[model samples]
Target: MFAKVIVDISHESIDKCFTYRVPTDFSLSVGDPVLIPFGRGKKKGYVIGIEELADFPEEKIKDILSPLEKEFSVEKQLLDLAIWMAEEYGTTLNQCLKTVLPVKKKTKNRTKPGKIQYGNPYPAPKLNAEQEEVLFAMQEYFQEEKVPSALLFGVTGSGKTELYLRLIEDCLSKGKEVIYLIPEISLSHQSRMRVEGRFPGQVAV
Candidate 1:
């Protein structure tokens, strides 16, 4: 079996899990502390997952040297929450570990996050039942995973843009921010015009 381990490193450059081949006689489980060879020396890491196959070539993956002491083991509940946040926020497990820990700072931020809203420059489009169904599926995913994701597959001019606008409306209702990415710089102007037409002064390229 192969294991996915999040090494105890603070550097953002190497902020990801490293897959290691489990020893034949080793006993390991998720959340167990393990010692793995990192660079020229060994580092302690927490096992987050295990699978039957390696993510890449089998020969390149390193072997987990040995299991660490029990004192270094992590709680399963905390580990699960950390894994979920890592997937949702595009973050590494090591960073999430620090995030999940209780902050000793006496004052907490009570201020709410700002959200962009639709401007009056353009009227919103009405979506058909099929389009609404796609939105519903994505919102359903949010309950299980904090991040909601859905694949919108259809031919051109199928009201896909309308669906995106609806999603932006939903996000704004919940006071959440959205990052809309465009591939080519040349298309950026056209994309911005479409979005700003609806959002007006609420958008920045």
Candidate 2:
């Protein structure tokens, strides 16, 4: 595998990644800091990506020397989240990384959250024929291990939340956790109330 490393350089090149071949038997992750051959000397770089093929010629590509700053080894998911934030907020990667992980400080270990408990969920109300059809199709998707994305389009007060509550109950019954994100803060109160009304203590917000 080859790693795409963003070398620590400032002149004529910023936010550019250099491709380097990964050594066999070395476990390289997305956010690992490593030493690599750059120019006529070695330099420290962050591993941003890993791929099967090398971007440069096979002979020209250099192997990553070793991992650096083991204490600061970032999580793959954290790095991925930083990348997403960078793209989402139109900011630099460095800025996003700093926001997520402050330098020189070890973050406390967090316990994994348990599966959400949708206690005695409220039964879904009777639905119109159209709504029933939509609910049936969506439920069928969950029969398989992989579920596809679904879009629900309707006018306001068209029982969209009812459909959602039904699905949430179904998922929780099958030991699946759900994460519902509210894009706007203003919408939080209403959405949270609705979800809490249906599932009780299952909601964090």
TM-score of 2: 0.45
Superposed Cα deviation of residue 86, candidate 1 (Å): 4.0
User: How much is 187 displaced in model 1, in angstroms?
Assistant: 50
lDDT of 1 by residue, 56-99 (tens): 99999999999986434656777877789888988877877765
Off by over 4 Å in 2: 9-12, 105-205
In Å, residue 165's CA in model 2 sits off its true spot by 27
Please give, for residues 48-147, the per-residue lDDT of candidate 2 as tens digits. 9899987668998888998786636657766887789878977667666655553464335444574222333454578999999999988997788776
Worst 10 residues of 1 by lDDT: 111-120
Query: What Cα-based lDDT does every candidate model obtain?
Result: 0.76, 0.75
Every model: Cα RMSD to truth: 12.8, 8.9
